[model samples]
Target: MSTATAIDADAAPWSPAQPVLEVRGLNVDYGAGRDAVRAVNEVTFTLRRGEVLGLAGESGSGKSTLAYAITRLLRAPGVITGGEVVFHQPSASGGPARTVDLLAADARELAGIRWVDLSMVFQSAMHALNPVARIEGQLTDVLKRHRPDMAPAERRARAIELLGMVGITPDRLSSYPHELSGGMRQRVMIAMALALEPSLVIMDEPTTALDVVTQREILDELMRLRERLGFAVIFITHDLSLLLELADTIAIMYAGQLVESAAAADLLAAPRHPYSLGLLNSFPALHGERVKMTGIPGSPPSLRAMPTGCKFHPRCPHAFERCSAEQPALLTPAGSRGKRTVACWLQTGDRVPPEPLGRPEGDRSQDLAVGGH
Candidate 1:
């Protein structure tokens, strides 16, 4: 893991010149009429060039829904009701300025942009790949789809090169999806995603199926590739520990909303939202000694009947009387230097201070040093 600190507010890493993708007030609804459920509720985030943003949450937190919505891959019963996914494409003049508004783009416009501008590596890499097709054909198919100008021979050469780029040998190109190991298949999916040199890539639970060692290796490889290619990435996962190691920034989702977002270091050091703090405490450290993990109790609320006020209040240990009546708006820290944002009544100064919750078994005073109470 890189010891490099996140870019400070003064650095402004997400400059207009380098903005690759921006999603604003994005909302996605599933089902219809009385059965409708709002999967994503006004979620907003941006992916800057060469940055990795980890979207972390438990199951049913709408992290996957946000990813599907951003890629325009949502299926029937799932509709993007509101918000805009803006994709910036570099202009011919070579200036940093680019075009925007991807959601409004027509099929022809999307055809020219998809894969070539934005690509995705979904969670189930094995299922995503064609079982009957050889690796070479699968990769070549992507190139042929977007770059039809390339001949068969040229496409084959490109496929070999891509396989090598992903740490697979050229000989493996003839192997079918069933022939490759899980990790290798995941890498192959990554290679296919990058085949068109898309400016942004969305990876949903990319390392979930792999073992610890393989997960570490694949994630390391991904970081190396990002350093080399300079494309933005949105990595969605439930593992906060992995996110701490791999992501530049971390976004915490609860219910159907983004509860908190901050630099990975800052978020780990001093989480603002109660849910984010609980999540951080839930994960056992990778490098540190193993401790008894106190997983967050209670399942996530159903999207159809989300709790009023703070959706997390139902399970939050710190929930007070006001928590059930008024929703908290997302707000920045009063004196924070960067883009640290959290949606919580505590941060909004709505109620009187409550007594501190008792610490967990492995709690160390120093562990809370970063994100002060």
Candidate 2:
């Protein structure tokens, strides 16, 4: 699908003053024949400076696809059909800002901006790190590539300082990835991503593999570093409870499309979309008594053969005949906080009564309790 034709009818207009990273009408397709799949469909969101935007959804909900598309890191089978990722650069003096369209940038342009201006921390830190390389070598590699004029001694000193910044000892720099624990390796990845002090950092389930205590520690450290560095963060994960503690805003995605976007507190307090409410209810709260958590009834639809009209109609609790025949657009709801938007027929003035959207079979309460929903 072309980016121009994939946009939602009610998508908000783009403005450079408010957003540091803006994605407009993004579409990603895999394969070339008639069996091609559209992994991401007209997804749009803005990340402001010094803010954390949480992109939450299930495993195949296209959250990671959007992240990779922003960085131009999609593989051969996957191609960004259209859309623009505009990154605003502060102008020298007091002049107007400069915007770079990441999708249209050539390799040389990408080289000048990547890592130096944008960085990423993948989900599996162990797989990302080179097995044969020392921690110090991996850390210094970034500096050596971006800031080649620096002396070797200075680079080593910077690497040690970065390790300390992430709460790891400088001595650990000599160790290999296998020597450190899972949490430690994750910290090293964070340190490497932050070494150049980029304006934006995209993290894909950075703490998913760690234990609860370690996850909490890493998130706390990340918030502290964000405050110190003043960079925007795009945090992608399936855990909503953890995002409540770290994200300033939240965007919920379903069936490869963003169903809702709102301020974190507003979304937790009152979600406009039924899907968002179901996701919130699936979690076990720390303060509330143990209750049977409700998981959303159906699984995500296959991207290659999505349902007609609204892709979510088949699973939406508030869906009606109109929902099945006509797709709902992302529109601002009344009493919404800030720039809150929801893509659902109920939010678009539908009068249908709420009904059961089918619940997942089996008791998943234990799973919810342990997984933090």
Candidate 3:
């Protein structure tokens, strides 16, 4: 992995209101040369200040890989072959922003910026926490490293405050990881991520293992904290329904590339891509009239032997001749009132646009269509 130190970061100016994170032409390879298997292919996106951007896709769609790549947490063999990840953070004294390419940041720079500027809440709470350590020990570790000036008593107070923020009692600070419930453990993970009060937090399926009710509770609590603290979030999950409820914007990934991105309401109401529509149809309506769950027909393509052109064409019901012959670039459509971008030929008028599947039963006035959009 490489960070863009060659760009002379100090010489270039940065916008005061620039996006928190910007990724351009990002590519990830599992191996080198002829044996390389491209996991993420030229994926690009941006995260604005204090906004929630939800990422959704089937397994192997590169959602988690993209997150790991952005945070410089990707392991060996998962090489970042190309791309620029720019992080814009406010100056130490709240002056103008400092822009740095995460890919080019050296170990020293990365260590300085990680918890203070950006943090990650991994997928598995049980695995993320150390079984042997007490909650106070775990939380205080970050304080000791990043805030060395903090006194021991002050650090203990801060740890208790963090626990209270996540709805855990201060008394639990003495308890070990195994003593907490699954939901509590996940909340602890969120607390740890927030201890430094970073500008952006990337949560990779943080509530995947919890029960539905517990998951919803954790998400609601997270939203409350976000509103209170004003931190941007990149919430990665395969659950579209959860995103529709919480995210400000949503992006759908298919076979390593973004297929559609729009405001949460717009994408739910009128998903432009066939894959997005199929995914919407796969989930049952929680409140509306019950409908048959219709999953996408085929499985995701393998990285080693990916299909030519649009990787999703083979599974897309609306795909045409051009889809298999040539790939489509993501671009904004003509009638989109907002910043809605999609990678479908039909939307770009390369083919006659088919009528979108009608709204799902029992919720005609709602923003999404589960029957098929």
Candidate 4:
């Protein structure tokens, strides 16, 4: 997987000005009627072409649910109740781009769009991979299904190339899922996801199971491939610190709703929402003084018995009267530096954000430890 011999066929020229995916007022629920518990609530965000949008939050924060909803991969009991997901497919010859309503797309239409236009790298490699099948079969299987035009030999060659792109030796293509290391299995999943060079890749905790060193290597390889292939990514993770490094734009989710979204640097320098601040302070800074880690107080609210007003207000230390009385909309802060938005009353008007909301001015580059799920 040297960059010099990389394949460029999947690198479709795209206009960065146009968004690749737009999720508007999306909602997902489990079961039906009153028994239906909301899993994703009015979540909205835009992912630009070739950009990395990171979705960070605590475990059971609807991160994976949101991903499944967007990709229409939700299973029984899970249903998309409302909202629209629009996918923009760029013109191959630089003409007007075509837009597809993902929510309205039938099975036939989705079959045409998936793999070629959009793909996903699921969270767990061991569970996602087929234990009985060989690595070569699994990798080539994707190509065989989607790229039917390719000959048998071509598919095999592509499978080998895909494995190599992620730093796996071609000789190991014959190995089964159980035969490979965790990192190797993860890399195989990545290769399978990229077999067709999708325009957008939804990675739901892609590196959760790997060691730190292997995680770095795989992430580096992924970034390199994204650069060469020109694809966008929705990176879902619990590690806010990791998103600070990988994502261009970061959206923080809490209790099934988006509490804040901003450029990665802006969030790092000055987190506007108390939940975001709590998340940052919860980790130990890699370079700062020995400060005590103050994790957020109380567990997340149960979907069946959610709190009134803001879902995070109970856990937010800076919660005020207004926070408990009215739900704060996700709106831009007054005099915000970038395209940052937070759902907190403190940042609504002239009121100053809490002192703890921001890192010290002297150490804005406070690298925090990556928390687990």
- The lDDT per prediction is 0.80, 0.80, 0.86, 0.85
Query: For model 4, how does the per-residue alpha-carbon lDDT over 24-69 read when each residue is reduced to its tens digit?
Result: 9999999998799998999999998899999999999999999999
The C-alpha TM-scores of every prediction are 0.88, 0.88, 0.93, 0.92
Error of 3 at 253 (Å): 0.6
Candidate that beats the other on lDDT, 1 or 4, i.e. the better one? 4
Quote model 2's TM-score: 0.88
- In terms of TM-score, how similar is model 1 to the real structure? 0.88
Q: Highest TM-score among the candidates is held by which one?
A: 3
State which candidate, 2 or 4, has the greater lDDT: 4
Best by lDDT: 3
Expressed as tens digits, the lDDT of each residue in 157-244 for candidate 2 is: 9999998888999889899999999999999999999988887899999998799899988989999999998888999999987776
Worst 10 residues of 2 by lDDT: 355-364
Least accurate 10 contiguous residues by lDDT in model 4: 1-10
| Residue 53 CA displacement from its true place in model 3, Å | 0.5
Q: What is the C-alpha RMSD of each candidate to the true structure, in Å?
A: 7.0, 6.6, 3.3, 6.1
Q: Tell me the number of clashing residue pairs for each predicted model.
A: 3, 0, 6, 0
In Å, residue 201's CA in model 1 sits off its true spot by 0.4
lDDT of 1 by residue, 17-57 (tens): 56787789998999887888999999888778788999999
List of clashing residue pairs for candidate 1: 269-370, 269-371, 270-371
